[model samples]
Target: MTVHVLEPACDWRAADVADETRWTLELSPADIAELEAALACAKARAADLLDVTRDDFPLPSLAPRLVEIEAQLIDGCGFARIRGLPVERYSDDDAALIYWGIGMHLGKPWPQNKHGHLLGDVTDHGKSGADSTSRGYELGGVALPYHSDGSDLVGLMCLRKAMSGGISTVANALAIHNELVRTRPDLAALLYEPQPYDYRGEEPKGGEPFYSMPVFTEHAGRLFVRYIRPYIEASQRHPDAPRLHPKAREAFDLVDAVCADPAFNVYMDLEPGDMQFVNNYHVLHARTAYEDWPERNRKRHLKRLWLETARLTDRPEKFRNFSSHWAQKRTKSELKLDA
Candidate 1:
């Protein structure tokens, strides 16, 4: 098979967008006021976070900007951040409600785990990385390697910052894919073959402990990627799972090498009230390990959302709502925090 390079507009280097303005939006005072009014409207109606629709939390003015942001995520840059939400002015629940409302404007909420959490929490959950069933988001103080989540879009809204570290890192997977195809088509080609991933114990009852899907797929002349090295590595623990082919191993290593190169990745410090969103197919994200404050209120926390965007209508079948099997067990992830 002949592997072809896809030079999407999102093929940006860290230096190309290091100016921040290229990818970050500092909300204007009017924008903030508009959000406040929207929040008030949603609250007045006593809307449940999960039940809130775009109509429920109206963003009359900011809605247009969100549409452009969605375009940027899918076509231009593959990632973006909206800063200045005045989170301290509201309680934790209120802040989360606001995050959920904004997320509604971008896409439909997708379940993040077996619990079918439309909204999830990212913080220390006391799970060890060594635990086979533990997902990276549940564990803390450890670096999460570059990987894409199980959705078209993934978002995080910071409510508090850690005492140290925890900087967010995003790598241009599109650029990495094109580079691999240009220099080493043989290795890049292998990635299009099916690769096994562990279910992390989320498989339906009596189902396989692991499943297989390709890391790179092409559909309707667009490139789509679903790469999570840790999960792929963990699948090896299942005897029934297919073994990683030697060529595939080489391909995975090349992908990892490209992601680790500073030229392909950019780091961002997410302060409280900042929200970041990334197109899962075009970008792979990670984080630095960090220490947390002892006080519950001071500990780092970020509200998380896995979204299905209308802008990406041509995704491969395998990547669409892959978590629906877990949706029957719907629930949210909550952390006990100080008020």
Candidate 2:
């Protein structure tokens, strides 16, 4: 197998971005005012959350900045956080509206789950981590391994934080891939082949329980990755799924090790009202196990959005979401568990 060294704009290490200010954008007072006005406008129109569009929630002063953020997501660092949203002043519904509006300006909303949820909640649903049907975002108090989602970008808005832990970590998958090419081209080449991924019980009726896609794909000189360690491991449960080659297993372990290394990843402790966005193709994101607060209102909760970015015009057929069945039912996921 022939492997080539390819470098992209997002191939930076942790040391290269040691300054938090480089990736963190703090909302200005003027920006906050614009957001408030937009929230009020949307509320006055009595627009449903799904019905709200970018024009309905105008951010005249902040829209240009969001355009820059969109570019950064596709062409630069591949991850960013916007801080200083005074969540204490707004109700939960109002805060969600603000997040939805901001997401509209960035990209078109994509359904996150099989339920066709354009909007989603990231909170504990009393799901057991050991359950094969459980998704990482549906459970709490467990570390989520680094993996890419099924979209051009993934956004999360923090409504509340955990009592302890739950730090968000993002690693540069481009850097990891390039490193593999340089050090172990054999493993890297192996990853470019098709690997089976379990659907976690969400496969369409009578459809295969597992689907196959390459872990690494290069198109138009850009690298794209889709990796879910648990899903890959769980695919073994389906006897018909392709068996993992021994070298493929070694390659998967190396990817995980590189992501966990301090030199390759950066950790962020998000506060209430902070928003984070990552390029799903270039970055692998994860969360640490967290302890929730005793009070029901204080438990960790985040609103999620999967976005189809306009900047990314083309993709490998395998990366495109071909699950039309997901669109058959459109509803938001608002599951909550008793504290």
Candidate 3:
């Protein structure tokens, strides 16, 4: 693998507002009005899409008009917020709708919603809940390490945070990539090799427990990244999985070095009503460990969506399934795994 460095061009907007990386663009009255209109229309939409009969789609469908609104917001700020909750909030459908709708705007639908996933208090089979951590020392409320997921983009809405902690973090993948190329060419080359990744128990039917891919991939001379260290670590549990070569370990260390620096990252404390969408291939993000108050109902809960975005970066053909474009056009929750 060849190391290549491409520094960002000077831009007043990108530079002027460069503190800690959490860019906050206050919405204008028009933006807020637009949001209210979309929210109203979404509530009016009734697609039996979320009905169980439509297996892949497990959430109500928002009208095209509302979806357009979400796209505009994503293009401008990479995130948006929508307020108001259902009066009869019996299920998590409403939350699902909001997450899915925004994801549609960002990219293609990658049918995965960690369905009814429980964090601290879960009592279901296939439990990968908060128990796996040693001594019950869950990384709750601690700033989670920065990593990317297996999608073009990820949508997260701050449903509710704990009384304290749960801050979000972001790091520009491009910055980190460029740094590796400039400072450690040998390490950068190792990123081209396949690195095993755990499914976190989410995979297609009869699929292996883990799969392998480079945490760092480059296509068309551009960077395409997917890194989740914890999941990568977990994949080690499978005996058949390949071990990281020394070169891969060196690359990981170099990546870590760049992430540890503020020059490549931005941190933010998401406020209520704030929703964020990230370019998963270009950004690495994480959350700080949080404290929850079950007795008082203050728990840190976030709705997550995996999106296949309209914008296509150059990538190896394997990553792009033939139906990827079509998948982007469909409504969210249309693709569901048994999980």
Which one wins on lDDT? 2
What's the CA RMSD for each of the models?
Answer: 1.3, 1.6, 7.0
Tell me the TM-score of each prediction against the true structure: 0.97, 0.96, 0.71
C-alpha RMSD in Å of predicted model 1 compared with the true structure: 1.3
> Which candidate model has the greater TM-score, 2 or 3?
2
- Pairs clashing within candidate 2: none
Question: Tens digits of per-residue lDDT for model 1 on 1-339?
Answer: 799878467788888888898888888899988888888888887746676778988988899989999999998879999999888998988888889899999999888888889899899888998999999888878889999999999999999989999999999999998998899988888888899999999987899999888999988877889999999999999999999888888888899889999999999999999999999989999999898888878888999999999998777777786545876755667675756
How many collisions per candidate?
0, 0, 20
> Which should have the higher lDDT, number 1 or number 2?
2
Model 1 residue 287 distance off true place after TM-score fit, in angstroms: 0.4
Q: Pick the candidate with the highest TM-score.
A: 1
Candidate 2: segments with Cα more than 4 A from true spot: 321-323, 336-339
Which 10-residue span in candidate 3 carries the lowest summed lDDT? 116-125
How many pairs of residues in model 3 come into backbone collision? 20
Q: Which residue segments of model 3 deviate by more than 4 Å?
A: 6-23, 48-99, 113-143, 321-339
Segments in model 1 whose C-alpha atoms lie over 4 Å from true places: none
lDDT of 1: 0.89
Whichever of 1 and 3 has more TM-score, that candidate is 1
- By summed lDDT, which 10 consecutive residues of candidate 1 come out lowest? 329-338
